[model samples]
Target: MATTTASIRVPAPPERVWQLIGGFDTLPDWLPYIPTSELGEGGRVRSLTNEEGGLIVERLEVFDDKGRTYSYSILQAPFPVTGYLSTIAVHEEADAGSSRVEWSGTFTPDGTGEAEAVALFHGIYADGLEALRRTLAAGSAQGS
Candidate 1:
């Protein structure tokens, strides 16, 4: 299995960051690459349309509000990967009043080389985390 992980520190509270990311259908709101998303199965499933018009289907496996984390599995995607499972977590940085967000995934490359799969996921995670940070910062600025 190929694994990829990315982390970012945002100048916001954990609870605030969780509010933006904890929901299964909120990816389009914080993921710049995902321009549209539709939810089904009572929000347990999400069909995301990326900026390039590629579609990806994912199912929510776990959503732990108390733990400030969620996990999901990719049911279908354009990537040459299988058994993809991803987890995202937000943790409070004490004394700084900020939050640290971590996004990690494991998957088996299906024909696509492991190196390519890892690189693709790394870019995806990094872009998503950066978008999340910017979204939170903009929101905070607007509220002040």
Candidate 2:
């Protein structure tokens, strides 16, 4: 299995960061690439539509509201991987006013080399975290 992890520090409290991303179906709320998400299976599953109209289906594996974290597995996607499992967590930074958000995934390469697959997911996670940072910054600017 190949794994990739990306993290970013947001200038917001952990609770505030979790409020935006802790939900299993909240990808669209912060991920500009994912424009829409529909919850099914009583909110255990999410169907996401990307900006290019590509579809991705994911199932929530675990959720810990108190811990500000969640784990999910991709049920269907266009990526070249299988047995994908990912976790996203928000942790309190030493600076009480800031938080660290981490996104990580593990998967087995399907139609691609292990290095290529790792690069792909790592890029995705890094880009996603950057997007989260921008979203938080925009929100903060508006609130200020």
Candidate 3:
């Protein structure tokens, strides 16, 4: 199996960050690459459409609101990966009102090399976190 992880510090409280990302079907709200998303199975599953019109289906495995974390497994995707499991967690930082967001995933390459699979997920996670940070910052500025 291959693993990839990315973390980012956001200038917001953990609860606030979790409120934005905790929903299993909210990816299109902050994830720029995900243009659209539809929920199914009582919100336990989500069908996401990427910017390039690729479809990915994922099922929510665990949603721990108290822990500010959630885990999901990909049922279908365009990437060369399978048995993909991902988790996203929000931790309160020592900084007055900051939070640390960590997103990590493990998977086995379906038809691609391990290095390429890792790199692909790395880039996706990195970009998603950066976009989330920017979105939260903008929202904070507007609210203030």
Candidate 4:
């Protein structure tokens, strides 16, 4: 199993980052590899249509806003993987002008490029976090 942890500080508020993370389907809007995700009651079923249109289906087992963590497993794909979990933490500083975002995940590569997978995870997530900063900076929205 391989693990990756990455973090970024956004000038926006934690609520804003939480909003973006809460909407699983919107990942495709900012993240490149995840073309889309289907959100559910307790978990989500996601389909990642790669750049060349390859499909990767995963079951997002844990989507906990209260706990700030989500787990997933590759149900079907071109690789072998299981028991994947990704957690995102958004916290506001006491000064009330900045926020911090942390992302971590555990993955067991199914004969795929572990390093690439970890890199992709951080890159896409960082981009997504930056997009959230832009979105919140533009204006406020209903809380997630």
| lDDT string, candidate 4, 1-144, tens digits | 788877777776666566766655566655555665665445467767776777877776667776555556667766444566777677677768677877777878766688877776677567666765666655544333
TM-score of 1: 0.96
Per-residue lDDT of candidate 2, residues 64-106 (tens digit): 9999999999999999999999999999999889999999999
**Local distance difference test, per candidate?**
0.92, 0.94, 0.94, 0.67
Kindly report which residue stretches of model 4 are placed more than 4 angstroms away from their true locations once superposed.
39-43, 79-82, 112-117, 134-144
Per-residue lDDT tens digits of candidate 1, residues 1-144?
A: 889999999999898899999888888778888889999999899999988898999999998999999999999899989999999999889757699999999999998899999999999899899999999989989999
Candidate 4 matches the true fold with a TM-score of 0.68
Candidates 3 and 4 compared: the better one by lDDT is 3
- The count of residue-pair clashes in candidate 2 stands at 0
Q: Per-candidate TM vs. native?
A: 0.96, 0.98, 0.98, 0.68
For TM-score, the strongest prediction is: 2
The local lDDT score (0 to 100) that residue 60 gets in candidate 4 is 67
RMSD of each: 1.0, 0.6, 0.7, 4.1
lDDT accuracy of residue 39 in candidate 3: 93
